[model samples]
Target: MFSKKWMNKSTNDYWDKISNLKKTIENADAIIIGAGAGLSTSAGLEYSGKRFFVHFSDFADKYGLQDMYSAGFYPFETLEEY
Candidate 1:
């Protein structure tokens, strides 16, 4: 379990790490990046709460999808449904 104090410390540590990483990326001649959940969220591809409801309300209503992650694995009857 995470306490508030621990969470704050972790957050500060992460920001410090990212700041250093930004400097490295800026100085590097070339860089490669791996993308996943964090990158997707950063790029505004989040699929829950307000964003999900706003963009995919029709899909959610028809398929009972709670989140976009689950929708990726859901089996639909037609290409249109998918």
Candidate 2:
């Protein structure tokens, strides 16, 4: 278990944060991580560019969607349309 003091240390030092994270991982019994689309995007799963244009060109044409992220909020009239 992580100490509250350790978790609450607000530091802007990048290497310090990495060291703390390393120690935390090393000491942990198990680890569970929750990540969002941004993580995938960082790992090269792009939301836009040629990939979006190729895969979602029809959706972009019909709904005026700009990217995969914005398309999620598009209010389609029915499930089939979505």
Candidate 3:
């Protein structure tokens, strides 16, 4: 198993807290999921080979991103630059 340590040990701990929030939402009057980068990752929307490269093969090869994580920080000055 991937260590919970990697995902849960961070000071921000957005992943664990978000999981807790999911459970809380079940009982709350309203549940709102704000989709953002971290949430997308939690939902398994990783930017690595599968999710990003599959759709953006050309981009991946040109920029040398093995996965989506690296792609986000492609030293990008602009979207067009990458």
**Number of backbone collisions per candidate, in order?**
0, 0, 3
Write down the TM-score for model 1: 0.51
Q: Which residue segments of model 3 deviate by more than 4 Å?
A: 1-36, 76-79
lDDT of 2: 0.88
| lDDT winner | 2
**Weakest ten-residue segment in model 2 by summed lDDT:** 4-13
Q: What lDDT would each prediction earn against the true structure?
A: 0.86, 0.88, 0.73
Kindly list the per-residue Cα lDDT of model 3 for residues 2-80, writing each as its tens digit: 7565554564657788889778888799766667688877876766656676788887777766876676667977777
Whichever of 1 and 2 has more TM-score, that candidate is 2
> Model 2 — TM-score against the truth?
0.57
1 or 2, which is superior by lDDT? 2
Which candidate has the top score in TM-score? 2
True lDDT of residue 49, candidate 3: 53
